[model samples]
Target: MIISQQLDTKTDHQVQAIPLDSIAQAQGTNIPFEVCVDHANFVRPNPQKHVNRLRSDNHYQGLSSQEILNLPPWKDDFFYFSYYAGLNGTGFMGFEAGLWSLSNSQSKSHDKCVDKFIENHRQDQRNPMTQLWIFNHKLKQIQWKNNKYIFILEYRGKGFQVINYRKTAWDLAQDQTVWFEFVDTKGNRLGGCTEGWTCPIRKK
Candidate 1:
């Protein structure tokens, strides 16, 4: 999906469309869940108890590991929500268990919304939240001005982690198009596509 943001330029604010692919490419392999999980494990040996409590919660009972990993499309909301729990320092298993609970708790309409949002972006990835997890990690700052057309994002970090961006990033590269600006966290224009850029968006 193209993320449009209202950037504060030298003269004034300009609306820019940041293709999601560009952002993914900039952030190489800094996967949030992997990092968060490792941090949690090193900080606490018995992190499983929290995970167990999450599993016992109404949202996540009787789910297999595979089920959590391969959550249904309708459960996308829960999947993304679990990222925050991980961001708050939950381990990989803790995140998975929380996701399992959330997936079971959401209604049909919520799942339909998830499906529609993905289709609207023409995003082909079966699990969009995986990419979102990465996006959330690099997203240093973001805000929506008046509407969707006006957005601002301050991304930090490098290298592509999401495979879904391959085709789009390739198309941009082959055509030699400059879709967005690559800047530091301070909003300095480093260059266009010559370098790399990152964009983060909330699923609507």
Candidate 2:
């Protein structure tokens, strides 16, 4: 799903795993979540009451996580709704650039629009919400633009990230589908990919 257009001056965004502090510290604000849980807990017959915090946060992101994954709230997951001030207006991470690679669980990353960011709570390796995502598009959050990274995403463990070009961050009218996070109904979005409550959507 990674769009490999002719790399030119038009595309200046670099995919560097830099520290989130230097780029967004001055402008972007990282609003920490009061309640966070693993993606595994959100399964059917929810485990804890605190799970709602996770469910609702994802639901608030335009579309609920369970719904996004095609898992209805009744069977595949629980039903919940919530509001978090920290997640206000955080839009899609479909920065409009991506390279869909292959992984095990979901599907053929290449054929489908998914990144292979895997996780295992049982294993020491976990996919914590890395600032690398928000950092990659630091300019979006800092500049005095209406569409910028208002809030960071609430990803729990590491998973594959598609190639992010970040062109849409500058031009909203552009074809957002070029980005790997593009959902058929929601356009380019990363909100449903996680437990939500935060994403890099467009807003003033």
Candidate 3:
């Protein structure tokens, strides 16, 4: 059961359950989460393509942090969200600083898990999703992560806005199987989710 669903920023939270067997097939093999991130990044390069840029050229090398900051290139909205290396941070290492769009922001629940996973790397038990993040769109919020924190930036949308996000964790793994549920802020189950899934938080 392979689960293939899009997490569009426009869609409200909804758990669209698909068969585990199907998800496995679509995923090809039951690859570790880290491997999945590497492969996805390799194939797609930048999932968040519209809002970010990648700078790997040598002309940008040896500039001090201040000089790098002062460059006109840094002012571009796309530049702000994208990642750059020291004229040497090519490939994966260079683009690790991901910029979040609505889709990734909406997945903050998962981000908490991701933050923990990244930290766990020091403990030698890594969570694999950290590498899969890309800066597809510019976010209005302030995104920052330090050694122990994953901060959700603030953003303004139509009439509603996001001020900040605190780390929250949900247990989706049970009895060797993972469980997922999604609901709007009002607790309404979104019906268009993939098939065979149930929204655990839905209003009855």
Candidate 4:
């Protein structure tokens, strides 16, 4: 049997509360539960929770040493919702630019995007790219913007980076589906193939 939960949004804006047991019995015990909020205003209710405090102060609060590969698609994707302040730490390296690439779990391959980037860069000064991704703490989505880096080897191979001011710090969160690419010296992101949040949808 399919159980439908209806929420009333008239005047008061009320949610229908039902027993979790009833819903679990209707679906199977082995299957995961899906909570669907039918229509969202897309309005953020709390502002304080979205702040990334680590960058605000010189001190840091370390992120849990999460195994990036272990999480489910949706949960893994939610890493975009977090702030990787550690990228600006003492052990941090310099920047790299990259073309947007898809995760292994995604239908497309990162190599395809990499190849396209290589092809595009062959004629221009920007060849041989690096990939980067970050968790957006506010939006709760993985953002590819400002995270990718493209490097030209012959230009200036070795150099040091100083964090004079973090312009990209404490920005809004981004969704993973969108594509972006750019190269910068100080803030260009690093790393390839990051884990994001798990999918909330149920398998039919």
Candidate 5:
């Protein structure tokens, strides 16, 4: 886009062209996350519209050690409580930092699974509602192989599943450190996830 300018040196030249980038740079537009690559956008593009209430374009690079540590807990995925990331060091952003997604964050995932299974189970001889999780977890690391340490996962929610989960899993300390690699449960990228799938942490 060109701007209109009035000049006396020429025969009434009314249009002037100026680079938008030049204007933008002159203004010293602040980059998001205080991160940049030599005044150039280093952040890899993503399909998601926003992260941390900011336009993704602001910061083109990855998260710094301090930045990752400061992520809000309420934003943590899972049914509600909290499931924060286990970030260490400056790393790539988004999936490039590893599958890094909480399938629960998808919101509709639970509904989709329950609805489909309920519809199918309604046809059974005995009336019952059923839903199953099939290898939904997509863990980037395998911690169970070495068997040097033990890892536990706990979930709290309604229904029979809660009973099982409670017996098998309970509350870990608040502000507990959990290493995770969120993945695309939508099947966009597969590590162990296909639609309706979740990544699992292999703990010994």
Candidate 6:
């Protein structure tokens, strides 16, 4: 969905804050693990378009191997997750990552089906690279405000990271949020993009 159209036109300082429960209720459901998998599996974009977009985007272009390795998990790890999750008819990309993190860190049950799925696709045409980060931290919280799903993640030493996923008023496609951010507990920005590719950290 187009985040710009979904947001209130008020200045950043004047934006209203709504509770997470209210936002989830209005949106119908929290971002379920199943939904993330389904979208990754069933929805297919043109391979050429995908490759070209990756090549053309300034945000992704001109990066060294070390730079790519050190990039944020969302950018580096999520790319492979999206690729592998979409490989088979089952979409388990985001769910697998979440489960992997939970299983390793919190002793949660790791779904065997997810592991087998990844193994089966290991040599597939779209060979997604293995994720460097296990994303051991679970989502600290998820809130909805101004037509966005605000995902809060906690890292051991990183304080807090906030991701805002927005939706449009009339769009039917259940797509991922194009704009997101990583912020700290005090509302200080760590990293993220604003509506028009503006600096969310600076804007905050």
Which of the numbered candidates is closest to the native, going by highest TM-score?
6
- State the lDDT of candidate 6 residue by residue for 1-204, as single tens digits: 000012221221211123212113354344322111111112112334333333453654685544433333322221212223342312223322222122121111123334533563565323222211213122444444445434444433211111222233322244444344544455554554432211223211
Candidate ranking under lDDT, highest first, comes to: 6, 1, 3, 2, 5, 4
Cα lDDT, model 2, residue 159: 25
What are the lDDT scores of the predictions, listed in order? Answer: 0.28, 0.24, 0.25, 0.21, 0.23, 0.30
RMSD of 5: 23.9
Reference-based TM-score, model 6: 0.32
Q: Candidates 4 and 6: which is better by lDDT?
A: 6
lDDT of 6: 0.30
**Which residue segments of model 3 deviate by more than 4 Å?**
1-29, 32-104, 107-113, 125-131, 134-204
Task: Report the C-alpha lDDT of model 3 over 82-147, residue by residue, as the tens digit.
Answer: 111222332222222222222344435334434443444445321112222222121222212121
Q: Which ten residues in a row have the lowest lDDT in candidate 2?
A: 76-85
Error of 1 at 107 (Å): 10
Candidate 1 lands at a TM-score of: 0.23
Q: Give a tens-digit lDDT track for model 1, residues 1-204.
A: 111112222221112223333222232222222111101101111235434543564555776544544433212211122122222332343343232222221212223333434463465443333222222223333222221111122332211111112222232345443233334456554333221222322332
Alpha carbon lDDT of residue 165, candidate 4?
Answer: 10
Worst 10-residue lDDT window for candidate 6 reads 1-10
Ranking by TM-score: 6, 1, 3, 2, 5, 4
RMSD of 3: 17.9
The per-prediction tally of clashing pairs is 11, 18, 13, 30, 17, 1
Model 4, stretches more than 4 Å misplaced? 1-14, 23-39, 43-54, 57-204
lDDT of 5 at 109: 29
Off by over 4 Å in 1: 1-46, 54-113, 121-131, 135-204
Alpha-carbon error at 57 in model 1, in Å? 9.1
The lDDT leader among the candidates is: 6
